[model samples]
Target: MRKWLFWLILPLMVGCQLGAPDQNAPLPILGEFEVVNGDTIYHTIRDFSFINQDSQEVNNQTFAGKAYVVDFFFISCPTICPKVKKQMLRLYERFKDEDKLVLLSHTIDTEHDTIPRLKKFATDLGVGLPQWQFVTGVKDSIYGIANDYFSIAQEDPNAPGGFDHSGRLILVDPQRRVRAFCDGTDPKSVDQFMEDVERLLGEMK
Candidate 1:
């Protein structure tokens, strides 16, 4: 769980297909993370579980052994969720066939966004199995996972939409390490996310 430990384990856990990027690549430099300050690479997202649309249990290992993009948003969110989800949908469309790239959207407002609600949301978005997961669970569990692992999600009473937060898309590698973080709202940011995914996947080769 420590930084150095994660760095030490990264190479062993990552598949041989992922090699470091070449000199001319456009992806963000991977080893320059210390310069980014708060953006960290995690070994695991602990103590969290949520039911998928099929009523099956899903846990941290759900994202193990691949490059995954994650976000926290409730379906009823009036402002950022809609825009954030649009980017997520774009991400899903971009890599739906790239079996190693996965997507997870978590609902911050658990009381309103139940498992059934998540099912409906994913259904409306036309997301099929084995590509994306729309998740909701206990309020504290959801909030804790967001705050501790992804460093996004907050609660506010007077903010524009009753909650104050950022539109962040988190990138995690096969070993559950945070590789890159992007602003989910901007087109270029999403493009950068895609480029990063490619870089990680390229490293796999």
Candidate 2:
């Protein structure tokens, strides 16, 4: 969908509360964007390979049959990222043990967020193991992949921390299609998104 159309539909589709009738609402499948039989087609998260905080290679195959949440950030970000991380912490604490769920926090500043830095960042967050991962890798590839997920991460001299990026937490289903997203800077929205997460997990089962 076009960017303007996306924002128009997003609000209407999100905010599903667990106890409400809309709790069972289906998540939207993002980006119908491919060419097949002389026509356009929908798209999904394409293949990618990057290094996680653990220094292990992570790719689409790594998340096969699993649903995951993703966000872009840099450790030294002076604005927005910390707030986003705070909410991400809430998610990590709650769903860390869910067998089918995982969180991929990718850094926009890949040049500076090395394995050691990400490892320390993960430590500082008090989340780890099979649940959460702070990833950093080739800058261009990371930026391009972020766009593929319908998120943004690019350098900006005028922006704080020298980077401009979206503060949205994206949800992807087992099939690698974007299911939902929320403003990571808002705690209330994250709370509602938490409910959506639970509902999605239950739906997948």
Give me the runs in candidate 1 sitting further than 4 Å from their true place: 1-44
Candidate 1 RMSD to the correct structure: 7.7
| lDDT for 147 (candidate 2) | 77
What does candidate 1's lDDT look like per residue over 1-205, in tens digits? 4456645754443322134435355333333234236775424445568877667777777766777788887776778778888888998888999988888777777677777788888999999677888777777777777754445676788866667666888777776566666778877767766777777887766
Clashing pairs in 2: 32-42
Q: Write the per-residue lDDT of candidate 2 for residues 1-205, one digit (tens) a residue.
A: 5667765765565544212546657755665555679986666788889899899999988888889999999999999999999999999989988989999999999878889999999988888867987788789989998977778899999999999999999889888888777889999888877877887798898
TM-score against truth, every candidate: 0.77, 0.88
Candidate 2 lDDT at 148 equals: 70
Candidate 1: residue pairs that collide: 17-204, 17-205, 18-203, 18-204, 18-205, 19-203
Q: Whole-model Cα lDDT per candidate?
A: 0.70, 0.84
Alpha carbon deviation, residue 70, candidate 2 (Å) = 0.4
How far residue 177's Cα lies from its native spot in candidate 1, in Å, is 0.8
| Candidate 1 TM-score, C-alpha based | 0.77
- Consecutive 10-residue window with the lowest summed lDDT within model 2: 12-21
